[model samples]
Target: MNIMSPPPRKLGRIHVPAVTLAHGGGGKAMKDLIDDVFVSAFATDTPRALEDQARFDLAALAAHGDRLAFTTDSFVVDPLFFPGGDIGKLAVFGTVNDLAVGGAKPLYLSCAVVIEEGLKIEELRRVAQSMAAAARRAGVTIVTGDTKVVQRGACDKLFITTTGVGVIPAGVELAIGGIRPGDGILVNGLLGDHGAAILAARGDLALETEIESDCAPLHGLIDAVLKAAPATRTIRDATRGGIATVLNEMAEASGVAIEIDEAATPLREEVRGFCEILGLDPLYLANEGKIVLAVPPAEIQAALAAMRAHPLGACAMLVGHAHAGEQGRVTIQTAFGGKRIVDMLVGEQLPRIC
Candidate 1:
């Protein structure tokens, strides 16, 4: 005779004030923490049943595109909370942007977080909620995840690793090597906001200003650009190494020289002042919500207009162009009408700014 398995047990809620080693012991405590903090927050998008892996309909994914895009990133920012975002929000958008830059429609993500033993349960809950909110804004789902609690001092308060899966529609090919001479380079908005904000938030500089991290999801803006400028060559988010690094990589990949106008590059007054005070070059600073794109000269106007129409690209500017010169070289035309080479970053500018 066949026998049926018992129904799944109801999820349990955690009553503890802080996490402990027992919560990672793979017992009731661990279940409680996951149920109370993670599952509940992601309930709307994820399956109710707790499975080892998330399953998706192949046909459903195929309907969106002809190819799949996968990307993963980890967030270990020193301060879990920041001026405009926290580690959780950063984890979601960071991975989403990675896939979006590849000309994909981000659909699903897997979040794995390592929590310190003494972290407050309330703080963990807040982070979980933030991830959920970010996923909603990006039109993606946190389908599955893992949580592990470690002893105090073994890890930071929390670190999140997110892996994303997306669909790249047919005829949407974007690559670094696709950049060509005479291509127009464009950027969404001001640079160095994220790097400057993190520096000021640390309180070590004794400097104060109203600068907030430009941490945001850019898939919507990207979609708009592609629709308008179908012949766009390449795109990259100016994250850790900023626009200077991105430009250099593009130049190297396409075997072309890129020249950017310093006056044409957008920079907020606060960020400029922060860089000047710290003796930092804003060009090499970090940004979380900015993108640098190369568009064919024929479609440059259409691309710029489409970007400016989007909320995220209202301040978008065509900062430079790609041309034939020294292979893999990037230069900047200063506001004072002088030119200089823009080299790759030598070392970490601001550790843990992302």
Candidate 2:
């Protein structure tokens, strides 16, 4: 069997010290930047012609499944680089997870970057290479992209928007409405690591911890889950709004009540203490590598076993279960033996957490 090597590091150099308006002028400067930075980093078996759009062979894509899953997301994390990942890795996996939750085999991604004039050229190169490495790990391609350099004051140092396309296998159906009373709520790993890690990275709180963002690609984990529990009702990546917001959405969509035990929710001691110090709720905190799944009771054990067997889902656990109660209501049994409503956050708890 042939094995694939990792993507090469730091493909090319940026002659300029900082990005300037000329880089976005669509002239020679822009072409050179594209060639040296993006092309070199994302090179594949097939040569890229630097075309306006990426072309895909119909037959090659059709082989994966019958339906296509498409999703797009934007990243503007305050710190471009974080403990476990950077903006580029977040952009790639963010869209990949969006497609994966829909039971799609993530295949391709489109990256568009908006860079502020005067931004360091090295920063741009680093982000591109991070994106390439992430794509290779996720088994997806960054096929086409656009770059725009705006005046320094017009935007942050850098921002990225990624669009992903994937194929959904035939006969696999997952929908929010499929959730019913008695279904089990499962999570792939400890919650709120990304949110806590980013908060600490900001340094405003003067707090310190060893927690790292759980940013990762989940296609392999999701595949293992489905193979074990084909009757899963829904799967969602807990991103910006965290598990609380995602659960609220699922509960509302399915018109079912969700009740979870706080003790059953897996959390790291570091994250637990961080949330306590900041008066933050882990449920409202963001996570890049965590997933909230609704599976039938009979298949819950099987799903848990499969998730534990996978690297990404090693921390998987049964967090809660669905039941008949007030429609669209979510309640949590507190550690103090009291129950309270776990509603959607009224406002942003931590901005740019994704």
Instruction: Give the best candidate by lDDT.
Output: 1
- The TM-score of predicted model 1 comes to 0.96
User: Per-candidate TM vs. native?
Assistant: 0.96, 0.95
RMSD of 2: 4.5
Candidates' C-alpha lDDT: 0.93, 0.91
Q: lDDT per residue, candidate 1, 174-273, as tens digits?
A: 9999999999999999999988888878777765566888999999999999999999999999999899999999999999999999999999998888
Q: Global CA lDDT of candidate 1, please?
A: 0.93
Span of 10 residues, lowest total lDDT, candidate 2 = 5-14
Best by TM-score: 1
**lDDT for residue 124 in candidate 2, whole number 0-100:** 87
What is the Cα-based lDDT of residue 15 in candidate 2?
Answer: 84
Q: Candidate 2: list runs displaced more than 4 Å.
A: 1-13, 46-48
